[model samples]
Target: MSATVKPRYQQLKDMIIERISSGELRPADRVPSENELVELMKVSRMTANRALRELTDEGYVTRMAGRGTYVSDFRAKSHLLEVHNIADEITRRGHQHSCKVLRQSRQRSRGKIAGALHVEQGVDLFHLLLVHYENGMPIQVEDRHVVADFAPDCLSQDFRTITPSAYLTKISPLQEAEQVVRAVQPNAAVRRRLRMADDEPSLVVIRRTWSHGRPVTFARLHHPGNRYELTGHYSPPGTPKSATGNVVELEIYDHE
Candidate 1:
């Protein structure tokens, strides 16, 4: 069976998002008006209007009453849930964040990874192994893979200075994402990477993200179970939808 094609308005939305991800359209920059898009893209005014209207509703752009629309100063967020960059999360908490790049290379997708990336086996992909630190203490082990076609220069990035999450999101903003939180005992290598105790469990967040309807990146973010957590807060059904997005809070529990 053939895959379903997206509507023209959705295509227009994706194009605008791609531009934003590439830094071609910076936050607060003026976006082309509906009339301009209709003329530039050769689409009907209705299509252009729907695209701009949806973008505004999704917080990607803000339409002024009198002035033109402008790109919103918003960080890229996932569709299912928020995926915070470790560096940004730490910085937001007023702590220093750093990382160590343990590995960066090209590898062929195999087994579950092939399916996870929505690519065939033996397809070449970029891989990175990193450990993130907060306030000088190791906190997260990030093992990630990127589809070669989506981010061809993934290997050249210095993850020690900029995290894979930050770099990838900038390359192709997330259109969709899924994450599974797990509690399990990690292997010796992962245990050593996060500097966890022998009996300590690991809090792992397995994530797969998509852009343009294809899965482009897969990651396993592991942390010391005793030290990290994720919590969610959503408005009740009766409450109005937030102009921003869902609220996700991170808490640290340092065990002795």
Candidate 2:
């Protein structure tokens, strides 16, 4: 009751975001178009457009020039994936999993996201943005780009219910994946999304996944350093058997 009244467009944007968070706006559900908003909310076309634009930027909806806008449901699910899946990690801890899809669309791959896939600049790629949850707690934010040719069904999948990681592995088996980790500070946008204190540090992991001997996707996962750790297993090209006559096939690497 005490909340102050915000601008008309901002109020509209917040209302849309609330609907998305409450599951009222299901994934892939189209929201009221600008024209509809102008009529229903008695707001100007510019105000309605601004609301929709903010929603799009916040990853609640996907806008297409001729196709209109629809809710996004992208998440990263884990499946013992020959690759890491963020959503799965939360479930493994006995936590209920969820995600707020920020964005999902076909974009021209470039820079590192392109380099990891070994694709040419402007190659068609599926880009995704999501904030991951565990037991209703925000844990990480996943920003990723996938090879369209490898997971053609990606856009159609509901990321809210099923993690994109799970969908990808199901459609195209993963052959190998490589991950790199580092520490960094959050930017203004990341800081706001993660709801972190100004001084809190963060850990970032970049992963490249391959399928059928070709790189298929690249992702950057961000986590609050204070609340998370990274773990993995590594083995050298070849190693002698141990004294117990067991081959050295596994090595646990837990990085905090």
Which regions of candidate 2 are displaced past 4 Å?
1-84, 231-256
lDDT of 2 by residue, 1-256 (tens): 4678788998788778778879898888998888988998999999999888877765668899888879876463232313347777777767888899999898998897788899999999999998988777677888889998888877887889988777777887746888888899989787777777789888888888888888998888888876766654332112223424533445457796
| Clash count (model 2, backbone only) | 4
Cα displacement (angstroms), candidate 1, residue 51, comes to 22
lDDT for each residue of candidate 1 in 48-114, tens digit (9 for 90 to 100): 9898888888778899877999998766644344557788889988999989888899999999999
Listed in order, each prediction's TM-score against the native is 0.61, 0.57
Give candidates' CA RMSD values in order. Answer: 14.7, 22.6
